[model samples]
Target chain A: MNRLACLVVVIGMALPAFAQDARKSGFDYMGPDTQAMQKDDLANPGMLSVLEGETLWNTPTGKAQKSCAACHGDATQSMKGVAARYPAMDDKTQSAIDLAGRIIQCRVERQEAPAPQREGRELLSLSAFVGRQSRDMPISPPQDAKLAATRAQGAALYSARMGQLNFSCAQCHDDNAGGHLGAAPIPQAHPNGYPLYRLEWQSLGSLQRRFRNCMSGMRAEPFAAGSTEAIALEAFLMERAAGMKLETPAVRP
Target chain B: MWRLLGLLAVLVSFDASAQTLVPYRIENGAITQSLTGVKGDAAKGRAIVVERQKGLCLLCHSGPFPEERFQGDLAPSLAGTGSRMSEGEIRLRMVDSTKVNEKTIMPPYYRSEGLERVAANYKAKTLLNAQEIEDVIAFLVSLKDDTQK
Candidate 1:
């Protein structure tokens, strides 16, 4: 009777680990060298953009000639833990907006500057700067009824097979993670890192840029930057990576 | 009439180059006929399977290749594939595994239609040509020994 009871207890203890989807940060999958680079601000190339962003934050531009600092004042204080909670619901549009989208909006609406092109240096710099403020903080996606519906849509997109290859994001990143595709290892694809520097790109990029690269590789029609599809996926990723530490302005191979 | 015939010829040639799938029937979950109506070179097939940018078979399957430093565990091992499945069965899978199992992760190598959101450059382009499919089938058929793994 005691043996059976112990056996039941053992099985009960084992079930949760197997049942729960264990989330891992993308940083866990990278090599020691890459991890070291990300750890040190001086060694990380993405930091240069952060530096540029700091300068841009304080400098006045556009017709109104108001800098981001003029309103927010001291990004380290105002922006801390901010990037961790995006893609947030924009009050005016009632649509999900990622960190980069928020910056572009601020540029256009608040500063009265011309909207910067997507993935351009100015945008990337500001994004990296804002994102860096939330480094090491856990991802905390907003909770709202509308946002939940959007998240559900994002989850559907994540699992839907598309392209000539007929692959979903879940297939490679979820089912085949930690396995090699040729010489490259497939990471769990948590979006904790943004405005990250990729060795292949040799420049800083946003999460949406990474999405397009994967879609193109799958021979799928790549989604445009700031598209509904892009925002939805970003929302889903942020939620999926909930509690994982942010590593914005990260370096990746 | 000659100009009309010439235009027709140009259109036919363009269509042929754009699409490379050869018609083959699926019966009882197998394609009994070879895609090219000719046997393929096992050596060439082996080369294609191992090439990182080509077959990409090792991405989701471990196989008998000893030299490959890494092989995936996402799907079944390719070892003993010949003893496990016939040439026709292998051909059907290579052509389109989704027909056999709707949830299959294997990409359709010989299919070009009914795919969603295909990039402009990849539209009407199959992952492998008819001859290439035969080559892969030939290589898979050679692996009859389960112990080779």
Candidate 2:
């Protein structure tokens, strides 16, 4: 009986590890057979936004008369591993560019098309489709010297004080984490679950929106959208949450 | 001249008292408290939860009452919290919830007494005054529904 009990205990201990390995091997983290059973929302006819992006991707505009399809080919193949390495720095521009910014660049310079407005459905759909390509791939960013420096700059920004309230992001996200600030337990502010659907915002938003919200919370003037500062901050956050699995389109409070 | 001086003194004292009653502000715009109050009405409490300009409690917590949309799923529900705690305990949590859990994201509705420096505009006030604290407490305690699981 003693031996049997010990064997049961050992099996119980190993259960979590087996479960983890199963998850690593493409099993759904939430439950087995769930992903297979789930319908693809993107494929739904209601996903007109994606259809619009597909059209825009193929359409030609501007002086160059080039379409995104001319250079990138089919999105599923070319966009693989793309979203995992966003908010990258461009040496020539001496600035950081998110996936949206990169798409805008392709539209303007490569295709000679008008830059799509930030936060527009064109950009969101394109980004969403691209991000979905790397759904199962682990996030990996190049760790070259320049990228490292940019990540460090973002780290500094994360801890720096701003606004009239004089609170740093670290204060709420780090120092006072897990505690309720009213009715909400402060989440770790991990970037693993980004491009999320926030109940408060009532729409999908990038990590940049959360950063802006933090600034507002601190009563600081928010940096402009697509600013290098916001990009660098994104780099820092993505790096900080390096090992965590990506949960894009996660629902948030 | 003496009568005028006495009247001025009375007016100054009244102003000082009013300032004392004002809430304390953190360097952030959030208000702090010392103790949660007990004078709140359930309706007012509900308003505070959903108020975009005030508590915004629905931003993080789901409660038994489901009428409000956009309830957060991350934090624990507060539907039966009144049963778990006394009114005084609830007040304490409201005033300075950080005292219960240091890592809590919840801001102190009171107890900004030891804050080193606050914004100039908010220096005279606490996050929530004693009355506001009581009001919130009253509201939370009223959430008790014996049939609630």
Task: Give the number of the best model, judged by TM-score.
Answer: 1
Clashing pairs in 1: none
Error of 1 at B61 (Å): 3.0
- Runs of candidate 1 exceeding 4 Å displacement: A1-10, A15-21, B1-20, B66-71
Q: After superposition, how far is residue A155 of candidate 1 from its true place, in Å?
A: 0.8
The digit string of per-residue lDDT tens for model 1 on B1-149 reads 42343334321122466585577776666778887898988889998898866887887788999998678777788999999999988988998888678788899887887788899988988888889889989999999989876
lDDT of 2 by residue, B1-149 (tens): 42443334321111454345433322221223333333466676666766645665565566766566566554567777778777656755676565556555555565434433344455545555666566666677777764552
Model 2: per-residue Cα lDDT over A29-62, one tens digit each: 2232333322245532213444566777788777
Q: What is the TM-score (0 to 1) of candidate 2?
A: 0.58
Question: CA lDDT of A221 in candidate 1?
Answer: 95
* lDDT by residue for model 1 (A3-70), tens: 99999999999999999868876777789998899889899999999999999999999989999999
Query: Candidate 1, which CAPRI tier?
Result: acceptable
Worst 10 contiguous positions by lDDT, candidate 1 chain B: B5-14
In CAPRI terms, where does candidate 2 land?
incorrect
